[model samples]
Target: MALRFEELDFQPTPMGEISLRRRYDPAARQDVYEVRLGDEYLMSSLFTAAERALATLALDVLDAGPDTGPDAGLRVLVGGLGLGYTAHAALADPRVAALDVVEYSAPVLDWHRRELLPDTAGLATDPRCRLVQDDFFRRMGAAPQDRYDAILLDIDHTPDHVLHPSHAAFYTADGLRNAAEHLTPDGVFALWSDDPPEPVFEATLDEVFAERASHPVRFGNPITGGESANTVYVARGRAAR
Candidate 1:
């Protein structure tokens, strides 16, 4: 049994004030974990279908590719820590050899290191997963020499709707092209969006990737008593500029 409601941690960050909370949900009959940035609820354990999909869908493409073999080990870069759904999902696939999670908020990394949330408890200790405190967008812009087999992003709400103005550039053609430089030749890039598929953004993918797609992931919304959906954009084979 869990308490009715409890705030586990709170901290003021450069982005905004963030808090971690846990509450007992009568409908699910279990404890629900939530992360809130300012007044905005960033994520909740009550719904995680899309977050998990962001990893699975991206890796599935790799599984189907010609590179997949018993000796093929994948290196993945995850841009966002959130509730650890995406990280945990990436780890679930044995093909993943290394995972680097970049999060701007130090407090979020601290929470995962502290093991305050069950979903992320082992994230900090996992040998394969590295918790990095850095701006994901900045790293992408730098175009570090290191490359990854797959890059999964779940930071922004959407291309149109971003938490910070700095992240806005990432959705554009040039920014996406920069991100594509960090991927292996056949590597994949996957992003999670809260909105439905946007054709305009899909065109941006065309400018950067040879093969790209946007997948709509629908899940049950208990609060609305109906279905809600999110989009997962996947791209691979960087296009010649």
Candidate 2:
């Protein structure tokens, strides 16, 4: 029998202290995984609808255009590796040629590399995916030498509620424009938010991309036994250089 609770890994990072934990849920009758940054709960395996949607929705939009086909061979960049759900979902698509997952915390990468999460086992060894240790926001602000067909962000809670102050600029028009510059003209940029769709951020996306839309992903809350929702914002057709 699996232990009811266990802390897999814990370490102090420049951002703060982060930890990974596993617990057996009597109600769900399965093992649940969780990630935490200091006292804040970063993510849980129980609620991953939005994380998976962040990848599938972006890939759908990237492949929907007439310019793409079954053999699109798309390159993708994922800005977070929480539980590896988004990356796993992206890898399921045959069209993804390469996937670069940027995680600011090295301990988090080590967890996946060690296969701590059974659901995302083999993710690190997969030839199509690379777990990169770097600040995702910094990468977005850098040169666009390695443009991607799709860029998905799931690091922060929301535009208003960021885990770090440094991520505030990303919700602004200028910040979004910089992110757009790193995408192919027909490429897509997507974000996952714990909050409902924010008009201000959607408007910023509008300013940066020729097309933009927001989606609300609702799933049954394993803890609450009610539906919980998260927002996914997808933008395509970069408007500015």
Residue 65 of model 1 has an lDDT of 27
Alpha carbon deviation, residue 127, candidate 2 (Å): 0.6
Full-model lDDT for every candidate:
0.90, 0.90
| lDDT tens digits, residue span 92-138, model 2 | 99888889999999999999989999998989999989999999999
Candidate 1 local lDDT, residue 29? 78
Clashing pairs in 1: none
The candidate 1 region of ten consecutive residues with least summed lDDT is 63-72
Taking all chains together, the TM-score of candidate 2 against the true structure is 0.95
Residues 110-162, candidate 1, lDDT per residue (tens digit)? 98898988865799999999999999999999957678889999998999999
**Backbone clash total, candidate 1:** 0
TM-score of each candidate? 0.94, 0.95
